[model samples]
Target: MSYFLSKLVRFNRSSVVGAVGIVSVGSTLLFSDDDTRFRTFVTARLPLPSQDASLLTLAVPNDLFPPHLPSFGQHGILSLSSYRVGPGSSSDISKEASGAVHDGSKPCGCFGRDTIANAAAKVGPAVVNISIPQDFYGVTTGRSIGSGTIIDKDGTILTCAHVVVDFHGSRSSSKGKIEVTLQDGRTFEGKVVNADMHSDIAVVKINSETPLPDAKLGNSSRLRPGDWVIAMGCPLSLQNTVTAGIVSCVDRKSSDLGFSGLPREYLQTDCAINVGNSGGPLVNMDGEIVGVNIMKVLSADGLGFSVPINSVCKIIEHFKKSGRVIRPWLGLRMLDLNEMIIAQLKKKDASFPNVSKGILVPMVTPGSPGDRAGFCPGDVVIQFDGKPVESMKEI
Candidate 1:
């Protein structure tokens, strides 16, 4: 008979139901005679709750082995014991709070319901509902609803560029009018000071008779995955809706997600962001804005994405100086090549090189710099100015 120890114990007990019994010396224990194995797994190591900790023992029948493991007719019991060390310092607590030890459950204390409620109460007043009226041939057609965050006491709002721009990707002038509704039920006309399509950010200003509540901006560079966060927005035309979630990832570049034109990193979250949530503020646990909710994957759940607040700040500063964003123009249409693209190209043309990555030029303007430099369709750009171009955004 052979004994096998596993930290994650899973088994198919269809052959033996009444022959097995699981006993726990301490901690919560659950038993089942069904064919399905336990859904949750126990970790090998657990931290000490205090200076003095006791031992915990768990026993399981040897017959409850998974199908992949070797089947041995063992009559002995499998005992698992866990011992806790001394008390951890404050730094260890901080690490745990930052989700260093993710146990698929929310940590206690700092992430309690009261903490989230307080954060929402503190930042709720600064969130505003934005409505843009769409018109065609001097007649009102429809309205676009979104959310915004007040960034200044004088009612300067920050939101997504698409909220203020029309369907044609241009700033809506005669066809639309910007309106901002505050949390206190006050509505005011807002004017688009500037909008940048590259970053999908826009700045709108409302000349309010009284000072408005401005939300505090936090440093997004300090954000980490699993950090507690709240998303405040008007989703599905609901006003002042707040949803809670954790930071799923940081430093996600646009090129990594098949969006090369953005040319910047994004903050990925699992917050319940839906339609009309765009341009809303993604606040941290401290009630400070860390990101702006942009869009989410339509086909997947819990795959929401946000624009980093730091990048939005830079664009806001640039808009303040110049009326519009100034981007270096290289008149060329290109596509970044990946493994799948290279495989498809090789199938069509056998002479195509088995390259790993490159930027494939699809078109070049007639009188553009690319045309002047003798660039043409089907040209693969592998390098630019002595540097390797792995993606179109890099070029």
Candidate 2:
């Protein structure tokens, strides 16, 4: 009787373990559903009515990977490989703050809706990715990235002058060859028809069968602080990437490219401007381009600037006419008039004022306007053409 009782206890333990395994398996199957069934359930329960269901469905791609599908954490599953599409697989789809589709067909009737999507969709086709053939340490290779539009059709492309011009090589000659890649992935050899390093603007031409979508030029001179602005470019080679920020300030003068001498008018925006985004368009509402993204302050956050398009137009005109640009020169050597310099100048000339003000002329061009205007080595220029000459920058 004791042997029989011990055997019965062991049999009961085995049965309990087998029952637990079956129950766990059943629970998993019941909770998880396949792509098709899940979609049906979601569609049925979706907050939208049957009539508006089409719009919600349109937001989702037809092919989306089902939930619970295993994904490796590193190096995302590449696009075409086992990237099963059934429920959520639209690479182009992203959320807009106002829930408005960037479709022109839809009425963006409300004012508060984020117009970024609409703006991006409007200008995206015009922005082209630029690639240049580079020879790094004697190895010929190709480097590709982003730049964008001022003109839509007739193959006229606007980008940062530095993008096409190779500054490393002979500064007198064309820097590097440029290739413009459109949104459709077609590439063409782009020639630097015009460029101005001073203003940092360049125009390239391509022959396309279809009429290109040209960007509508807006008046950057009219741009004010707190105005709505958008920057669209390939940040890190990611094409048609749209970032939204306001015009942090306009007409910000910083000696970013001091080598170019003096500063030009700049539109300061908080938009994330990356290296590849150079030569891309900074647009405003109504889909008009106000500025061209140029450089960003490295040490500070949210500090990015663009060359005003108005300043670029004259340069572009010069490129169209001359095939090169001739930058205007004031032709004078200037130094900041500070206290140390003021004391030294006062010691030399007792007639000079004690207050540190105005730009001190160290040397003036003999044949240039400065010399003609009686400006000498010791002369303190309080004003230049009626503009206050404060520092070397102002001078």
Candidate 3:
């Protein structure tokens, strides 16, 4: 029972389930997001009677595996092999979210119905699967698949920094190779041009024989909650797979997600993003790319996050001219002051700052730039560069 439960599916609360079943250990489990199921090929290293089975291959109902693993997870699966468990399989969200099919992407009509096929028609070809080096008992291989978006005629692809650089926190650059496969079934050698750890965005180049199709960049600044969007990626090694969702929050703060950096804007969506969907494009109704699918919340349903394409635009533009991103850094741990935080701080110390609007500097690095400038811990920064500041972006 334990062995069979190891293949358990991590289901999202929001995803709809059409059927449920169990597969024994050494047997097979089927998966699908629609009625028309495709043959899925799953390869795993299992300890079965055949002790020499380095990789166990299986044929399932749908040609996709649910990322039910611990990594790259939340309510949705990571789309990798036991890596980031993909969310549990369920029926289409569009049909459920919207009561009717969309004649066009009108806000009052249908929310997510027919727009998926339309966005897929425009941006699907640009979605590519990224295969990076993986180590199985010191034997290097390229089996871990992540997704990417082709954005330039010169074959420039946009992906997450975690996908191509220092993967899985290994921090090793001497990996075997990077392979990019498009929806057309054409594969090419890919090279990492630049990667920014701060933004978790990376750029890659593919030597294509001809000008390739690319996704159109859209204005992410206009994104609002409840706006329909489509997430396109190769989750579970399923190439060109698409998921439908709506924007849950336009400006999800980085700190709220337990990230240890200055706050940044992220688009929260209910898209069924899986492990292989990392670095794919989140497209709007007009078939314009709005964001890049980055990650999902763990142990929660309908909580996926994406880096706004507007940020990607800036990072890519910087990469073009300087071959890297230039970021202004301050060595201080700070938080945006709010009414609740201020009230809590005062409870700890009656002498806490009475002011409500500003950034609370809790800790400052010993010898960093901020220290050299006479900054100290427990200080409230009300201004930066002659402007009153409340958030890190102001500084």
Candidate 4:
């Protein structure tokens, strides 16, 4: 909110009434060197200086490439098939526009308007009920029920490790037998291949008679705010329950919620997720799984969190390679560096280490991993694994 004074015109013979050319952008006032000119701009923006000094107007750029196609038409990404039944066969008018057809009738299979329905169909069958029978002191106790997603046709399930792990028992979830019930009412005995407690991701394998329905994995990095997504799970043990909502956020920090020992970040959505919805697939409109439903705020409504499918994929890769997720942590507190933060840091000490980019390492715990790794307090970490890092959140 500032204004810049450009040219000042003195009145006839140093008169008090002077016409001052003031440039204003917001409510801020800009004055001349002698404090004579002052102006406050509200809604209007000051026009930029023209090449001709005599002119006080603005120049409009010509549209070098104006659009020639119609605004509303068949999009190339979701265009209908043009193939006909035969050479002399009449064109089917009913299925021409895929956006018009409804249920029970011949499905148009439109990707435009019916994305929600299509996503539900693809993800519903892949979502399965994961039951972990808890054993205490060699006795059969109650079982914990959660959800899982079939990520592979050969009965490979993607779920949260917490789902199969009993909170009371010190034993691993893989030691116990897990029962996976598909949406089609087929029950299969699942064996936990590996469970990464750091990321809350688990991989389960089952022997199936035939190929099972699986969900496609989407790029969670492409997800943005307001993107339509469907949460498919068996919430409260209710079968095939689907909730529709928009992606409220993509990278929500787990530390901000005071949640310890969880993945650093999570995908936040407004979709309804209950106790039994954990490990369910958060499906996108393209019938692809973008995230895994993990937790929901009990006190508030519409607050749900999920693990990004991309991160889960990474954990699974680690499981396949090392059979465990290796999370190396450096006990150093850092801040995202910016111009304002640099100025603030310089105020405290003149030699605050001049850094224009990267995260600001403010404190390093003594005898911690960071200290043993030769990390200093005032050092700035510009890259990780040879890749440039700009913010702490992104790192």
Best by lDDT: 3
Sort by lDDT, best first: 3, 1, 4, 2
lDDT of 3 by residue, 66-102 (tens): 2311133333433332112122222322443333223
lDDT of 1 by residue, 116-166 (tens): 555666667888888877667767756777889998999899988667754
Stretches of candidate 3 above 4 Å error?
Answer: 1-113, 136-138, 167-175, 333-372, 376-395
lDDT, model 2: 0.55
Report how far residue 184 has shifted in candidate 1, in Å. 0.4
Give the count of colliding residue pairs in each prediction.
Answer: 0, 11, 17, 0
Score every model by TM-score.
Answer: 0.63, 0.63, 0.62, 0.57
Rank list by TM-score: 1, 2, 3, 4
The per-prediction CA RMSD against the true structure, in angstroms, equals 23.3, 29.8, 18.1, 22.4
Q: How far in Å is the alpha carbon of 214 misplaced in model 1? A: 0.7
Pairs that clash in candidate 1: none
What tens digits encode model 4's per-residue C-alpha lDDT throughout 1-395?
00111111211211111111222211221112122233221222212332111000111222110011111232222221111111111122223222322324454456465456555765677789887665567676556778899999999999876676433212233346778898778898987776654456778889988999888898898777767787877655666878888889899875565432223678889887665677888987766899988766533467777889999989888777666655555666555567876675566455555567676555667997767776655566776766677765554
Better of 1 and 2 by TM-score: 1
- lDDT of residue 308 for candidate 3: 98
Instruction: Tell me the whole-model lDDT of each prediction, alpha carbons only.
Output: 0.62, 0.55, 0.63, 0.60
TM-score of 2: 0.63
Candidate 3 or 2, higher lDDT: 3
